[model samples]
Target chain A: MAKSTIKLRTKEKGGKIQVKALITHPMETGLRKDKKTGKKIPEHYITKVVVEANGKPVLTADWSGSISKNPFLSFSYAGSKDDTVKLTWTDNTGKSDSIEKKVGEK
Target chain B: MKRRSFLKGSIAAGAAGAGLAAGILTPNMAFADDVADNPFKAKSVDEVLKMLGASGAESSDKIKIKAPEIAENGAVVPVGITSEIPGTTEIISITAKNPTPLAARYTFGEGAVPAIKSRFKMGKTTDVIAVVKAGDKYYTAKKEVKVTKGGCGG
Candidate 1:
């Protein structure tokens, strides 16, 4: 099972639910060489992020090795305050993480 | 100009704009009429557009990519994607020079601002391209971000 590596927060204001998420990952580009030993670093990155509310996806992100080590994303939608928001990510290496947050909880 | 006709015209324009931003009709589908699978899987920038079924993109004066001329560290170089083009429904970021140039892709819902802020890793200095999809067309802009320290396995 991949780790639950997402930190997410939601704010309800002015009839909209705003969401912000931060993910943790190495996001390494399969380049660079070891200084001590000559070997290339493996490429590892979170390639996709899907954000859903009440099972209806609102945002989907596709990324590459060029993304930062850890990525942060923020967006808002016209959703009910009682909706459940879920975030999930998958990497190029086949590892993944997912988390669920209820809007009114925070 | 007749008052009622003018009002109806503006309303129709606003509705069209909304329809354009709502390009991502479903959560699992983006540009529902254009694609069925993920286009970001594309290894090259051109493939991304092709995946989206875009006719073609042209250099534009409205798309803006904000990044440092010299990023102190490659680990997390902040980048801002802002498109002034009207009816922008999607934005695609490309590291035109990355080993695999298609960096990131995003779709905006109707009425949401067409601006994106994120960070990307730089293996070395490279030109960053931003492709904005507005209604049925695509526009592009680019900037060169020089990385002092290699972020990718450099």
Candidate 2:
């Protein structure tokens, strides 16, 4: 199995679930030129990210290359412990990755 | 052999038609089409807002943007947005001076909070605008973040 590109953490506090995720990606803007090659890099970035709680989507985000490399995202949702939380991201090149975890577990 | 090939072709066509219908019916598929069409490629914040059907958004104090006044490294600038408006369905972040101003757009569903924290790149000093959409109306807050170094180039 390939190593997961996403690092996710969720905590249930005060009846709310705080979710923080860090995704490893280059997020190339296509405008940058390689210092050695002198050639523009092709545009590559994550286009969409979806976060679901208990199999239902709680948040969705559309992103561009302007987002920093290895993007970090944090948000909170009203949910209880033991609920299933899943985070998935799709990039422009049709590459995608996802990770699932139970709330309050790690 | 000819009849067998003809029947296979017809089956493939039927399958494609069904897939097209399913794509149209799925909300996620429609959203994918929308993303492919506009906003991310827009060069200006105004153009992005227009594509999002949020032109002439009003300035609001209820929206708060937390970011450093000056960033030593433009490659990674931490930013956060909090919307106090009720029924806020969406939040968008824009870096005014970036080549592509529209940075990110987040949609919240039921049981979700209206606050978000993320990181973005800045080519130079720019105004970071946070737009909040609530019940058909758009509200915005702006904060200036000065970048000591640009982030776009290698």
- Which parts of model 1 have CA positions greater than 4 angstroms off? A1-3, A104-106, B1-55, B84-87, B109-112
- Pairs of colliding residues, candidate 1: A31-B153, A32-B153, A32-B154, A66-B121
Residue B19 in model 1: lDDT: 63
Maximum-lDDT candidate? 2
State how far residue A60 of model 2 sits from its true place (Å).
0.2
TM-score of each: 0.71, 0.86
Q: Tens digit of lDDT per residue, candidate 1, span A1-106?
A: 7556888898888878888888988787666667777666777888888888888777777887778887987767777778888989999899988889999664
Worst 10-residue lDDT window for candidate 1 chain B reads: B28-37
| Candidate 2 lDDT, B25-83, residue by residue in tens | 77695665654547888888878888888788999999999999999889899999999
Off by over 4 Å in 2: B1-37
Docking class of 2: medium
Candidate 2 per-residue lDDT over residues A24-69, each given as its tens digit = 9999988899999977899999999999999999999999999999
Give DockQ per model, in order: 0.30, 0.69
